[model samples]
Target: MKTYLPSTSYEYATVQKVAGTTITEASDVLAAEEPLEIRLGYGPAGQRQHRTLSITMRTPGHDFELTAGFLLTEGIIRSRADLTGILYCPDVAKDEERENVVRAELVPGLSLDLPRLERHFYTSSSCGVCGKTSIDAVHATSCPVLPTDGPYLDVAVVHELPARQRAAQALFEQTGGLHAAALFSPAGELLLLREDVGRHNALDKVIGAALLAEWLPLHQHVLLVSGRASFELVQKAAVAGIPIMAAVGAPSSLAVQAATNFGMTLLGFVRQQRYNVYCHGWRLVNQQPAGGPDKVA
Candidate 1:
């Protein structure tokens, strides 16, 4: 068993706070960010087609989920059953290095496309692997264009999602420097929540877990992101089969465009019982007729 260690998600650091005429020095716990190398394994049972997928900076914990989730959205692994096993690489030279690298083993007779692995484009914590080749690149092979009849999202439920998502963010409550991705049912029931210093990493963890729990193409679910909705984040959600995505911040221009292209409902500034629907407002249960909304959702 890997022995228990103190929290590595946050570390204490001393900083000076400058006032009008005084300088106060105190310790603060900042969210931890470290490099996590995600590797993939395939080929015959005895043969290891090991290859490095991508190395991203993420908060500690949920390393395997992050790896699986990344592969799922990348159009590599389609479903949870495609995953054979995921663990920290046994080749770590030191104990502390164990958490720095993760390897995912594919199921028997299954293998990854070597050329597709080249598409592993994430190189940092801020940006995900959106190479901007084309709008169609964001669409995964496993994800057909979302139909118009997936799930219904009420404006009231959308407004409540941010508060509920905030309540479930334990790490964020402590560090205030982490991003969160939460999954909710069509009825607004919070299902799963994951947090990380990287926005992309947070979505990866949740989608990875859902994939394991056999919950792909979460057609009847709503995804709530704690930060701004980016094209990459929306792309990840769409890959996971999520129909509606609500964000507490603004949606980027590309993000709005992609959501519109995918026929997914996208909501922004989802707080205080108000939100803006950038695209696919048809899915909002509070939307009005050809006229205006009765009360303006």
Candidate 2:
């Protein structure tokens, strides 16, 4: 068993702060961000193939989990079994750059659709995927439609999530510039949390941790984000089989639509003891019908 600890997530910077007319030298904590290149190794024993899969700007910590989560969400690898090992590249010339590169070695003889992966990586980098095409691509992946059965959440429990997630965010509290993703039980017990400068990276770390722990198909838990929900985040959660996703901020239209299409319960503005349920309201206990007696609008 291996455990990954976060590297330096924040750094100190000296700045001058002006209050009214007075200026004073002060030290500020800034969230660290660096480029992490994820490489992949595959093929058979004798002749192995290696390629750079992605290079993302993220806070330097939880590098392994970030790599694992990125591969899983991209549909590059399905399970932990798909990977033989994940390690930082040791061939870098500089010490600072050593942890910036990681290699996820796939099981020998496993097949990959390289062209499709290239297309996905290109579209993601360019942000040029149309809404319909993006949703359709999600449907084309191994991700399944979420179950509508249970994990019935209590409104009171949901109200406490934002505060709880905030309190547990050590990096956010220090730097005040990080996003967080948290997993919680139906009873509002915080299960796992990860923080990073990038929202998606934070989520990938959480999902990667869950995958390492063999906790896939998170249909029985609720996921909460410190920021607004996006289509990419929803797609990742759907791929991980999470039934409920709540964000402290608003959700994009595409996020709402994708959640609806996936049969997931999406909640937004989850603070101050209130929230708006965009889709699948039936999963919330004691939720009243909005439009009329027969419907929940």
Candidate 1 per-residue C-alpha lDDT over 132-216 given as tens digits, one digit per residue, 9 for 90 to 100: 5445765636555676786877776776888888877777777789999999998889999999999989999999999888876
RMSD to the true structure for each prediction, in A, is 3.8, 3.6
Off by over 4 Å in 2: 1-7, 288-297
TM per candidate comes to 0.89, 0.94
Provide the lDDT at 70 for model 1. Answer: 92
Cα lDDT of model 2 by residue, 1-297, tens digit: 333235477788999999999999999989999999999999999899999999999999888999989998888888999999999999987888888999999999679989988988998899755687788877887687677678799877888999999988888877899999999999999999999999999999999999888899788989999899999999999998899999999999999999999899999998887788899978898655566442322
Which 10 successive residues of model 1 have the least lDDT summed?
122-131
**Clash total of candidate 2:** 0
Where does the lowest 10-residue lDDT sum fall in candidate 2? 288-297
Candidate 1: stretches off by over 4 Å: 1-6, 119-133, 288-297
Task: Please give the lDDT score for candidate 2.
Answer: 0.89
After TM-score superposition, the amount by which residue 183's alpha carbon in candidate 2 deviates from its true location, in angstroms, is 0.3
**Which has the greatest TM-score?**
2
